[model samples]
Target: MIRHLTNGISIVFISWIVGMIINAFLIKTKRYQEKLTNLNFIKSKKINKLIGIGLIKWTVKNTFFKFFNPKLRMNNKVEPNDLNILRNEMTLAEINHLIAFIAVAIFALSMVFKGKYLPAFIMMMLNTLMNLYPSLLQQENKRRIDKLKKVFTRNHVSVTATESLNIS
Candidate 1:
């Protein structure tokens, strides 16, 4: 059982790496970014809470994984450009996890067909926790960033208009 658990974890990590590599290629295309940006599996915060994304988000923020990608965190004051960068990073992360989840899911299904129920269960559970949850979390964060970006732009436009009226 221990060996199986270790192997399952190892497979998940390997799949994650593979997914990153694959995403690097996919991201070169504009269509990929557009699709990911528009992808909304959950529409509202209430739905996000019902699905437990808040829990997964809290876990990532509180765990060692918080240190995994420092660039994703907005520690200081965020500007419009910074929000754009973070949104792009979030999209990259979301797609990477999505690719990893699909790959691991295929392997788990194969294991089930082979009657390796224990290993399959282990892989599926880990895949859900590691890949699926992270992807969902990124999507959630992206939504927040989008809303923030809109506010910044709107405020900027209004301020510019006010300045023009004053000049007039």
Candidate 2:
């Protein structure tokens, strides 16, 4: 059972790495350039307006939570009211991880059928790492935001007073 699981895991890891490399290459080459073109020539301002409204609602919700919800507040961190936004940002990372997992599973199955163990075990670890990477990124971003907020807060008082006093 352990050997089969390991085999599945390794194949998934390799396939996932390949997928990410391909995605990076495509991004650099502007292979999906059409997406940019479509966004730029948006004919319906209605969609834009709807998006604006949605943003406003999200802002209001976030503000309410950040100011009023103690449990949601992190020390010096902006509390995101819309968890969906975080999830959306994570979607790409999740997809990459999923791809890796699938590849590993396939590889493990192959090993089981072929009576191999070492490669399968290796892939399991790799796939697990790949899938967990996105969660790491989310934590990193949170830390960065906290640091930025501290910097801005320190400067804000001086900046506001300067503006109010009409300092040239």
Candidate 3:
């Protein structure tokens, strides 16, 4: 019975790791890139270029989240439903990654307890990579936002000057 339980857990863990890796590949390749870019082509002036930039930035962040969600175990500050949608859409992948992560963690802890250094070192490296992927997306968003703010300010100034001249 104990052997069966360990085997089952191992299988679950392997499946999760495989699924997360697949999703990560898909997102990083930017398959949905053009779909969201089309949103910027709207005719309304109110929509503006800034909105498009914002949308693209958001899409990148969301794609990053969807890809490696299991390893990261992240949450959205603004919407709970978004997290649910992400998990649901990538169900098998998310499940496999999470289970694999838990299994690896347990294995690493066991090794550490026994003073087995090499396995623990490898597991820690993998864990660090999983954790860092999400932060890269977040930092990219901040950089994009700073660039957008400058553009927005420039556009605001030009529009204001044009309008003031017309009024005179």
lDDT of 3 by residue, 23-121 (tens): 555444444343311122234424433334344335434675345445323332313343334333333332334445555667667878999666565
- Which prediction has the highest lDDT against the true structure? 1
Tens digits of per-residue lDDT, candidate 2, 30-143, equal 534443111222234365345343343244345552342233223322233322333333333434444455655676668767876666656555555544433233333333
lDDT accuracy of residue 117 in candidate 3 = 67
Q: How far is candidate 3 from the true structure (C-alpha RMSD, Å)?
A: 17.4
Name the candidate that leads on TM-score. Answer: 1
TM-score of 2: 0.34
After superposing candidate 3, which stretches have Cα over 4 Å from the reference? 1-87, 128-168
The alpha-carbon deviation from the true structure for residue 90 of candidate 1, after best TM-score superposition, in angstroms, is: 0.5
Q: What order do you get sorting by lDDT, best first? A: 1, 2, 3
Sliding window of 10 residues with minimal summed lDDT for model 1: 159-168
RMSD of 1: 7.0
Q: What lDDT would candidate 3 get against the real structure? A: 0.41
The alpha-carbon root-mean-square deviation between model 2 and the true structure, to one decimal in Å, is 14.9
